[model samples]
Target: MEKREHWKSKFGFILAATGGAIGLGNIWRFPYITGKNGGAAFVLIYIGCCIIVGIPLILAELSLGRRSQRDAVGTFKVIKPGTGWFWIGGMGVATGYLILSYYSVVAGWTIGYFFESLLGTFRKMGSPQAVASYFDTYSASPLKAIGFHGFFIVLCMIIVIRGIQGGIERACKLLMPTLLGILLICIIRSVTLEGSLAGLTFFIKPDFSKLSTQAIFEALGQSFFTLSLGMGAVITYGSYLTKKDNLASSAVMITFLDTFIAILAGFAIFPAIFAFGLPPDQGPGLVFRSLTNVFNAMPGGAVFAPLFFFLLIIAAVTSGISLLEVITAYFVDERGWSRRKTVLTMGTVSFLLGIPAALSFGRLQGVHILGKTPFSFVEGLTANYMLPLGGLMISVFVAYIWGGRKAIDEVKVGNPVFITGRIWVFLLRYICPFIVAQILLFGVLSEFTSPRVISFSEILRYYLGIIDIVIAAGVIIGGAIYIISIKRAKRREG
Candidate 1:
């Protein structure tokens, strides 16, 4: 059989990869998380983690994928051979599927907001409380949310079914730059607001007291998810790259662009919140509710409000397309399914699964899978636990078992400049996996152990307690031992 063709242009690959990275999470989650977690201190930690942990893992996944030239499942099978590491690919595809189910629902909100903004619905909505209630009403309506979600899912499926070059690449090329441009415009406008400097200071100022076990762990998790690392999204996308493509440079570019958008979003949003005297820690409603109010209060509230939401919708749609492609590609490659079949089947399944999240606003509010939690339990489990575990597995598989060092060598073969081998090896072999595993274990334990309504002082005390440090250390050591033992067994076999 003839060899499969790769992405013809670097722009296509970058756009597609970036489309996966820049999503609703960046726009909605980043600002609020930054505010609650010591503003600038958290942002700094997040950036550090992104470079040290996110970039290396991205290179590892891309190297693995490009070398194998296969979907997520096939990539693992090629690298690890007889080992069951290929199941990581399956996990990734599943994770993408699970995420898109609810993710599309949230994406639907952006879509709805885009139209509402355009029509000047927000112009008359004067108060933050009114904007908050608007979100509450819409979020609780299952039928309306489902309608918009279906629209978003279909749009994603249409683009994904067209293959990498024709559909995914073209959309990203047009959208990514536009998304960045909108963000910069928003940032410029926001920074000029009265008291905007306070928001900026809040985001950039460091508070060492805020450094706790849980905060560090949360930062680690955010770094992983925000960059779309460890869930096989990057790896699966990487499988399409040509041999001459520079994995290191590509990873760095993707990380930088992703981080820039996230930070820019913070700059745009927080200033507006402060300007309007809205609460900084508005939880998930910060973007949908608080920012909507800010737009209403602005001079040209109607015009800018719609423009902001339009950019958000575009960013979200592109990201959704990438997630769908991961699963769609797996089905096409592994099960020999047609692209249309794969797209439709996955979309239908995701659409149905999204109903719970949609209904969580009202009727299903009492439905708790883990315990007494409401809307975010399912989201939290997948993001905090499954994503990190998948990442740890990839780190170990590439760094130790699957010849990631060898793959890195292959990746650097044609480049004029090379990444520092020692640093790359150190991160791949020790630092990345250790950090990821620590976050995963500690995050789970803390969630289970910590009270939901604890006082601020008590929460602070819990973070600095001896127990937290021991837990973090134990998790890291456990990962190192697992990887070392696997390497030893492989050596013995050789």
Candidate 2:
């Protein structure tokens, strides 16, 4: 087997990992989630979740990766030669592949919007309606959207093909600082708007009254999903680590930078959101539509319009490349494929897979498997089920199969002071799996049932009739497998 590649420097790995964590979701989703949930109180819950759930998972992923020095799937196999543990990594690889398919589609939109911003398209849209129409026109354009989608894939392919140090790390090192600088300029301009203070106040002041049970799960989901947790992406990145790198500090820095950038994004956007009198809960189009109007009204509209959109594209690309690496890492490590072969094969396939999602807004708008856009349908599958399941399996596999002592030893590689053992293990053993299971159930159940408890009977009917079928089948098949295995073991002994 070919020798594995490692990060050239610890800082480079951190930046790359941070770039992965800081994606389109951080830019677009996090602020809206915070605003819609509990404002600053939601932010606090989110922060707590990051500390309790997100950071611990990050450490687990990094420790697992650096110790095994393999792709997500390979890492599980390395620890336990023949077991269901490998499926955990396989699920992670599939999650990364599945998410990236549609993720690249969104990244492509950012790219198109960047050019639109450069042409001052957003600057002329003086009203939210006009901005919305503009976005609708652009989004509904099949040729333009798919063109950008294909282009984004090719661009990511370039970086992934270059090998770790030369490709992924190099792009992130440049992208991170540049993204921060552009964001700072936008924040400065946004805060200077007349009513921006109200928005800032809205964002900073805690309102514990708004933190509901659903919002609690929302915070956990956001924190878990935001940091690229539960996906193989982090573990794939971690696989490139050298022995000298500290997994704990790297995970902490990645979390800190990712969270800081997310909050900074809130500061930058909320001021504009309130200052312009836009609706804070406008769903996915908030950034592209309403914020475009805010950009038009700002004094530095001409400059920051392009700058902000450029920032969006940069963030998306950095994230897109990182996800691409997960699939690339698997093929390269486990299949004896070269970097170029893996990148081309996986990148092309992902781009092709994304076609339906890109077309979902226009060509396939009405096409639904179970009353959801193709994009949204896949997003739900991966985010709700696949990603959380991957995270749950990882926590369990590390805590039980690898054993607590060995897991800690992998984590304690660079630290003489290993004090995080007790709590981390406890969370890994119990809390994380349980939280993830709750997230999966709630995430799905919310779609079919109202958050209100007005009709318990209706929910129970649906749960028993539909949900229980999947559960029952799983149990039945699992029991059959166990019985068959036991009988086979007895035969072998005889």
Candidate 3:
């Protein structure tokens, strides 16, 4: 067997994990969702979700990985043999593969736009409509789209092939700080623009009336997705952690840093959007179309345009590395593949898988799966179904099958007397699983039903309210009673 590689330092592990968490979603998706979901109200709700859901899951995955000293699939096998629970890890590996496949295509677009911004291409386009047209044309070109997609995949391959200390850790150390530095610069420039305060006001002020059931669920989903949980990326990174590294503090730091960057990204982009009088809810095009117009019109636009896109590329690459790593680790741990063979083979295959998504914008534009483009279909499948289900299963397995007592013992390896083990396990055992199951159920219903007939939120509000209340009460009461039993057991043991 090949010797396993470990992270060189505690800080290296934190940076790499945080880099994985801070991805394109943070750049493009989170801000727009915040804009659409009542700004500060949604932001506060999201923070609460992170505390209640995100950290416990992180701790769960990390402790499992480190304790098993294996990849996601292997972690399950090592921990619990002769059972089907390893399929959970298999699902996670598959989820990472699917997410990274098309994700690289979008990452490639950031690379393409970075160069275009550098060459003053957006400067030539006078209106957001003009920039939107240019984006349409550019995305429609099969050659450019696939070429950059391949390019980004190759970049990920290069970094991951070098192994952990020399590659992922080293790259993330440089990338995360640079990402933050550039983000700070963008925030400064964005807020200094004339009339930028309007954007800031819109972003920071809470309007409770604007908050809806849909917005609450969106916040829950965003908090879950933004942390990169349920996909085995965290598990793979955690497998590299040393026994001395504190899982609790590390999870907290990673979550805090990731959320901070996401909020700062809003600060960076929202002020510019409002200053230019662009609609806040510009959807996915907020980055490529709306921001390009902002860069074209704002003072010192030329210099910051490239910086902004470069920041995006770094963000994409960081997360891309994690997704690719999840797949690569599987092969290395399970199949006895060398790092080079695993990275090269899997990265190439991922790039090939992404080609259809890349071409979906251009040559494959007419093709639709289940009434959506290839890119949209795959993105929806992973985000809506696979990730949430994987997360829900992980929480259930750790809390029930693997047993929360075992999980807490594993987590206590670095911090022997940590008091929050009960709390963490309570959330992992009860709260996280229930919420993620709701997300999964809601996503399925939303996908299959015509919102024109009856929306999923409406179903939740009008039809399922009593059942939801019963489930919530049961979980809370069950968790509290379970905690008391644990306390009694500890007392007897003492």
Query: Compared with the true structure, what per-residue lDDT tens digits does model 1 show for residues 240-301?
Result: 89888988889999999889889889988888888877767778888787788788778777
lDDT of 1: 0.79
Ranking of candidates on lDDT, top first: 3, 2, 1
Best by lDDT: 3
Where does candidate 3 have its weakest 10-residue lDDT segment?
Answer: 461-470
If the candidates were sorted by their TM-score against the true structure, best first, what order would they fall in? 3, 2, 1
Instruction: List, residue by residue over 122-224, the lDDT tens digit for candidate 3.
Output: 8886666889778888988999999999999999999999999999999999999999999999999999999999989887888878877677678778988
- Our model 2 lands, by Cα RMSD against the true structure, at 9.9
TM-scores of the candidates are: 0.88, 0.90, 0.93
Q: Over 4 Å off in model 1, which ranges? A: 1-5, 207-213, 372-375, 447-494
Model 2 lDDT tens row, 267-351: 9999988998886777777888877787787777878778888888888888888888998889888999988888998898998
**Candidate 1 minimal-lDDT segment of 10 residues:** 449-458
**Cα lDDT computed for each candidate against the true fold:** 0.79, 0.83, 0.89
